[model samples]
Target: MRVLVVMGSKSDFHIAEKVTGILDEFGIDYDVEVASAHRNPKRVEELAKKDYEVFIAIAGLSATLPGVIASYTTKPVIGVPVSAKLRGLDALFSIAQMPPGVPVAAVGIDNGKNAALLAIEILALKDESLKKKLEEYRERMRS
Candidate 1:
């Protein structure tokens, strides 16, 4: 399966790399795009329509990326809060406090690593082989 990583700004690339690395480790394919929740909403909408197992939204200021993805897609959205002037507190609040109906699993600030893990978890739901791979990955982590 493939995942999509959408960053609100090009500056968030460093953080998105962490998630992409994890996907590589698991042998999962993914595509990355630079789009703003505000500046490039149309691209975001289009990406949501593409074939993707998960969407990792990374943004520093307001954490709007994940919510926007969740609003448009039935696929799972995992949010990576990037470091900001507020030290990502604003982003954390914005992502975590999503309305009850729309859910975006939020990760720690700048930790696309966790965002990737969350994506794997969601993918495992319908993929037995990937689920086993994930279990092995977790076992290896403890080893």
Candidate 2:
């Protein structure tokens, strides 16, 4: 499955790279890009039409990347709110308070690890090996 990791700013690279690492460790193929909901809105609209099973949008501040993706595609979009000023309250509120209809699966502020895990969960639906690996991963975490 091809997963897309999109960030609103290049500044999110440091945090978002961890998600890249997790995907790499799982042997999952992914494409990473920086696309702004404000600046590169057209690019965002285009990627929405491409073939990707899921999207993980990592952004702070206004944090509308996930909602934008959700609006553009039927594929699942997971929002990872990178911590911004105001102790990430701004980020959390921006992501958590979505109006009716548009929904995004929001993860913790700067928690790219969970973002990767969530992506794996979604992909594991059709992959038995991936499902077993995820089960083992969770077991190791608990034990």
CA-lDDT, candidates in order = 0.89, 0.90
lDDT tens digits by residue: candidate 1, 79-143: 88888869999998899999989999988888899999989898889889999999998899899
For all candidates, what are the clash counts?
Answer: 0, 0
Which candidate leads the pack in TM-score? Answer: 2
The reply for model 1, stretches above 4 Å from the true place, is none
Model 2, residue 55: displacement in angstroms?
0.1
* Model 2 accuracy (lDDT, Cα): 0.90
TM-score of 2: 0.96
The residue pairs that clash in candidate 2, if any, are none
